[model samples]
Target: MTTPMNNKNSLLVELFVEELPPKALKKLGDAFANEIFGTLRKLDYLEAASAKTTFASPRRLGVHITHVREVCPDIAVRTRLLPLQVAFGPDGEPSPSLLKRLEKEGATLAQTTRAFEQDKEFVFLEKVAAGRSLRDGLEAALHVAIENLPIPKVMSYQLESGCELPGWSSVSFVRPAHGLVALHGDTVVPIEALGLQAGRETHGHRFEAAVDPVVLRDANSYALQLQDEGAVIASFEARRAEIARQLAAAAVKVGGGSVPIHDDALLDEVTALVERPNVLVCSFEREFLEVPQECLILTMKANQKYFPLLDAQARLTNKFLVVSNISPDDASAVIEGNERVVRPRLADAKFFFDQDRRKSLASRVESLGKVVYHNKLGTQGERVQRVMHIARGIAEKLGDAKVAAQATQAAQLAKADLVTDMVGEFPELQGTMGRYYALHDGLDAAVADAIEDHYKPRFAGDELPRNNVGLVVALADKLETLVGMFGIGNLPTGDRDPFALRRHALGVIRMLIEKDLALGLDALLQDAAAQFSAIAGFDSSKATVELRDFILDRLAGSLREQGASAQEVDAVLAPFPQRLGEVPKLLAAVRAFAALPAAAALAAANKRIGNILKKAPEADAHVSELLLKEPAEKALHAAMAEVVPAANAQFDAGDYTASLQTLAALREPVDAFFDGVMVNAEQADLRLNRLGLLMSLHAAMNRVAQLERLAV
Candidate 1:
């Protein structure tokens, strides 16, 4: 090891471990680096212009921070003592408590009395405390960062006892750690963790390293040194980018415009699995291609972690790419080994597909009884029956008898693929395989397509269901889940949503709005709840209202994600617009109306009107012709007679923006009425009349949205 630099230098810390879980490597790396940076900065070791670079590989997580001070400067500290009143008495003598406190702090009465000042309410003392050593700070920081890692699961292992006959002691971490390296500038920081003392020694790739303990010379040279001598790409993102590059180049070599499957998650996993990435092309027999490409691709990716290459048309080619940890002089053995490993996986996929096809989805329906959807909600078979009934109702509302029958049939068969062997192995292929089997069983093409598409819009920004049958079934399926789950009090809380109710809610919202379905939201939910009416203690009324609220909350979140501001979303969604398809138009009207010169004043005036109406006696919003004694009231009344009709006509035609703009004419009259008229006159008739006029105005202004919510 080299001697330490005197002043500013880079800082490096590494935890070398056994192979880490690929799924959590990125999060673990980010958390570790941030924790170390935060700790060092708190200790005043980091400069303002310093930068932190993180490195992570299959075997290690490390960070190199520049501009860290070798030693923190001395800091001035003020210690608060007793209050002046308690430290001194009116007789101008030190209190006994003050004497004891000063003695406990190793301060004399004369010095403590000098610390008291008339300007300060509390007596204070000052001292210059020596700064912490880098070794001490790093020890605490390493302990905290390791303990705080966001590890999915931790393992307990036996570490050999120091200076003994290989006696074992237990330790717990994400993985069994073997080495730690903490260097400041050119010297070791003398930190210890994970039952090991810090050093400049860390091993590289298991096979391809030029050095065993890849001796890191200094903090700033860690990355380059690893690459040069150890043959390991130490940066996770850099290695991932390299893999992506090689995968692309290998795809081009296939010569058919083919490319590897574009999956960021798969790319990250592959990066975490290898220290040195060597991309190789391999192939299997084309006969395995007879199986669905989804099945083959899923097996290749999920089981073997291989990326299947696809042609320009998005069809899977027999060729695929593997990311190997070793790069040998000749890669023929590695390529052959990977290819051989993947063939059996693909063959297992084909065998499952073939065996599943022997029985139609219709015959597998009886087997679903064994699958429990939820303990409280009964079996999947029971839920399927409920979905089928709700789908028929929704279909009948959307189309004729034939359409309704087709929808029920699709819903009946949607969950049938859950029992298939291919889907059993790959649960993500549920709806996809159902569509294929439906076609094989000679079902109508519409029914087959519906089986596949009912689970569309699976996530945010995903596509909606394709056809009318799909719309009906998707709506029915999602509504059944929402109603049943909410009925059983399986509501989602802050973080836990075991059933993915949010995704289902968003799916329902996307289908309704994207398809522009004319089905009424409340009516659909009520009908869904009524199907479970026979179940003991089911309340259709309460469930409908709760389900509507739950879905509306999801709608607000979805609308905000689509670029609607909070005010715009609140204005449109506050009333729980059951005709959600019309919400876009309402928001557009609100946005356009907000931009007009008269919007703010009108919004304020509407807010004033709402406040006035809420406090007044209960009265119908009807103005008696005889009670319009004030000129402002009569003028506002005449204006409303002209504008309300035209605005109502526009609103009826779905010209929401035009309707709101027409109400802009009310801003002047509204301002005059509020400023010139007292809505609460002593005369009861006059007060009622004014309240009525204000109520009518409030109703018209909020037809498109709660315009008052836009008020500053």
Candidate 2:
């Protein structure tokens, strides 16, 4: 039965199908609901305050919308024709053009009028067009919504025999659709999609549903009916919250300050895998806890979708929480089944750990030679050799023999774990497992930590390496990758960064700035580029220049993200400061200098001086006192004599803010000189002398930053 025509009411639409991919469920749900709402609103089939609610589960995707209209109101539409003069003759009678247009529009001369548009008069036809009906609008909206869904993959399946149209043998969708429901109030608004007919029937939990094919009562009662009879929590967010509450309560029941390990992605996946969540406490053998907690936690979370509990000190405990879809009075059978299933998985991890320890990391180094790093480059062994040399070069720049040796050792052993049994089983454990093996080999604590810390800052906001040796190796590793990739002309374009060069550049910047390392940016690039000379196609000279520009651009963006204004960043980075550690101080000085009352005048005068110096390209910073005949030029020279030395001393002392502030004293003389002196004098020496005077003042004023960039 259908609702009465032209009535406004809340509407509901649902698609019941096979289980969806848990990782992509949320995205699919959002895309479906938003596309439907947008299409309805575009067609003027919604009330002003119409709102939508989304529901998704393992076997269903649905949306409930309020204040939908059965029929949209009529609106006025205009159709343009030929120009006024062309449409009518000199006698004011309709011409052939007007006749043809009127015939096509089904209009008469009385229905046509002259309107002004685009600075010209045109003949236009005005008509009232009836709005679309709900059935027509909704059918179109459904097709659009389904077509635009962000399905990770699609599958084709044959419709049921004798159920659909005779020729409709197959259909394609993210999953096979079994039923669809389109409700307007208590009445079903008939629609068809994916070889399924619209109805109020939707199935719930496979085993716990109180009724088969639960029938919804109305558009507003779908969620309640599903929960009361179907034993399903239909809304994704509500179900996730419920699971969280149950997980927390289950932890409390276990005592010993145990809490389920927190991973939002795992929580989301668990929420999508169950229609009705039942958090059950399960346990495994305690001997497996001897393995690294990361390995165990990863195995459980990634493979079993189980939450391993952590004690008060955040150590993994044997007790874990599992979110099951069914809740029987006797949960012991289910608990035991899960426990028995996880035992072998844990044993595999234990076996791998025990076997991997038999051979020291140094012995595994030879195996890396057989594993290819990049075809254009060389094997993993060759890459490791490059990284060791680069690390040594960087450490030597710091002038510490002990740190240099430590960095080389760490770099040499970093990639050896790539061939280990544990790392081969779980690639994410490559660096982590290396640290364990290094320690077991009786290596230094610093070297062991560096093996793991070299991959620190794997993502944004991640921590940096812990020790100086780690820092040196991390920088060297990132630099080697960056220089090698850029040399091959393999660069990131738009959103596609297969090489992750941008990340490597940012990592280098963060370490240099955060650690305040006294390293020159150009020299680092040069040294890195120097290691790639053996490769045939590698262009060291060109890649080094391009890579430098790339890194500086990234630094400018980073500084802006950290709250520095664009202009301030430009001023500080303009000179391309070699010691990147001093960038923060330079920016601070620029900001401080910008706040002074004399700052505006000084910046403006500096800009004017730059323009004048550009005209006299041969001007040097040597001002002859004898040629300083004008009072303004002499006063400026005298002021610089007193202030330049003091500013230079402050700049040399690394007191950047004080250095810029000291230059503030020259603003008056600078402004007076620009206003009173004619820099382009007729005599050659006079003009050259004046230009040299301005050049000296410009040099002194811009010691901390390019002050002209602060000009408004």
Candidate 3:
């Protein structure tokens, strides 16, 4: 017998699209990658190493895979057939008369073999399926994956001259599939399905050479050749590194140690927009620096996809760097072209800034009513009123009346920028524009900062509210969103979170936990739910619970992301309506208790306690001191008496670990009582008494968590 050796190797795949929008490019790449993984898994290709790398410029969307397995594993296929009795007459064998009739009619076998499953008792046939060559499998898989790749929009193109005018019109792709290069090892696999012939050829820059094709020996050689031939670097990290290096050098030349590269999104867009990126330094009028630095940077980044340079003082400099995909013979022309494009954008930004500065923040209040928030939610003005009320409630909870009042004022004016011409043109400038406009309009710095920071931590890993007023507004804003949508029964279903209520709830949870504010969610949700009463067809009570559960789910997910186990998350969350921030403290306690040597034993004891109490008829009975017969039961009772106060103290102090430690002291006595005594004794009163003692034990542990749900 020969043993088979496992082949552990990577797979490489690349998709060449005509062009893709940068915003949609990442998602498309991710989807394709996910689909490939899912499809391969379904096909029983578990050992195949795969990764999808996507690259997009104006002309092409390229995806490269690495570490893909050569072939799916060999599988034992089986087919089941109908039992012999069903195929023949009931004479204990095939009947001669029936056989003669079947022979005359040319009847075939009554049953045939199908695929294998464990549920079948018998199989008629079984075969060992040999794995195909990596090249063959990859070709087949790639053809299917490419044709099925979901693109929001698709285009078609004409094909080479063939009899009957080659069916390009019948083909569809995200963009017209201009060309495809499918290489297996060193050989090109002909793709006959898509009307493409596999060739050891690929093109460089479209303008650099009209049709220069290179043969690739493998993936590594192919990547190198593509870069050497004026093709843009296909790797995202490589392009980012090149951009960073060029930006650094430009900063040094401008006598600044570094420049502020503010927009990560713009950087990603620029990186995707180019194949061969060349960094160029361009100077603008120094007077432009007088404009708010944010406005200038936003204009440059949003319009031109340029990186702004700053001096050592961290102030904006007159210099900016632009990344150009094409290498220019006269670089000055490119610089001149970029400067011309940036001028009008900067002029418009300055005009908006100047115009916005003239209006007072207080005066902008009336304008907020003109901006619609949501169709059913009335205007921004109404939402602000809700937020103001919520903020005041939050402030009262925080014991900060002054900041609460400040938050109220801030919330009322927060949406004022929505009515501004500047924010209307630049939607991204909503909170930011408010802050800038507020500062210019001579509002208090705290109020202006609150207006801006209320939208903090907008995405994962983003910063949360820094100021008290900001925190109040953030809570109020999120609460209103959750309450309003949930009241109307427009809850998020699976991936369809149209209102972004999940994000809002998650943000609220993060803000509260991060700020360590001990405000109760129940009261807050109740207040928020109350506001929607006047609205038609609202269910306030159900909405309140749904909103809390939503926040709690996010909290659990966030904790799990921080390396907490699912069991631990459930154990911590088992107690409903607890302080949201205290969840981590509770989990830490549970984990600490779990770590102790006696923790498992204590958990076992608690489990037994719960089980006994569940079977008992009534839990109202108390064990009398006179009824205690066994020394173990007496010892357990004494231990519970001593541990209860200490456990309660630890729980109150938020020292869950200490509480669990205190509870663990009862484990030995609990074990002894269970081992020595029968919980369901013949004497009804005695059994009832034993059950009551166990109920008492449960009561002490339930102060922290329901132990039954935490079962191992």
How do all the candidates rank in terms of lDDT, highest first? Answer: 2, 1, 3
TM-score list, all predictions: 0.93, 0.95, 0.82
State the weakest 10-residue window (summed lDDT) of model 2.
1-10
Model 2: runs farther than 4 Å from truth? 1-8, 93-111, 165-169
Best by lDDT: 2
In candidate 3, residue 273 scores what lDDT? 75
Error of 2 at 405 (Å): 2.5
Candidates sorted by TM-score, best first? 2, 1, 3
Candidate 3 lDDT tens digits, 1-712: 0111122243334555565776566556656556555565566544445444554445544444455455667877544444444435567565564455445544433523433357543324445578655556655666666666667777765554561225543565676555666554454555444555555566667655334765555554555666776465766657766877877887787774767575678777877677778889887888777677877887788877899887777788878999988886889999999988898888887788778778877788887788788777788788888888988988988898789789998998888888777787788878888887788877788889889888876888888877888888988988888899888888889899977877888888887777778888888899988777777788886678877787888888888999998887887787774577777777788888778888777777777777777777676448887878889989988888899889999888878778888887887888899889888888877888888888888888877766555668
- Cα lDDT tens digits, model 2, 340-433, are 9899889999999999899999998888899998887889898899999999999999999999999999999999889887888899997899
Q: How many clashing residue pairs appear in each of the predictions shown?
A: 0, 0, 8
Largest TM-score belongs to which candidate? 2
In model 2, the clashing pairs are: none
Q: TM-score for model 1? A: 0.93
Off by over 4 Å in 3: 1-17, 24-139, 148-150, 160-169, 182-189, 210-237, 260-264, 611-618, 621-635, 672-695
Model 1 bad stretches (over 4 Å)? 1-8, 82-120, 163-169, 400-402
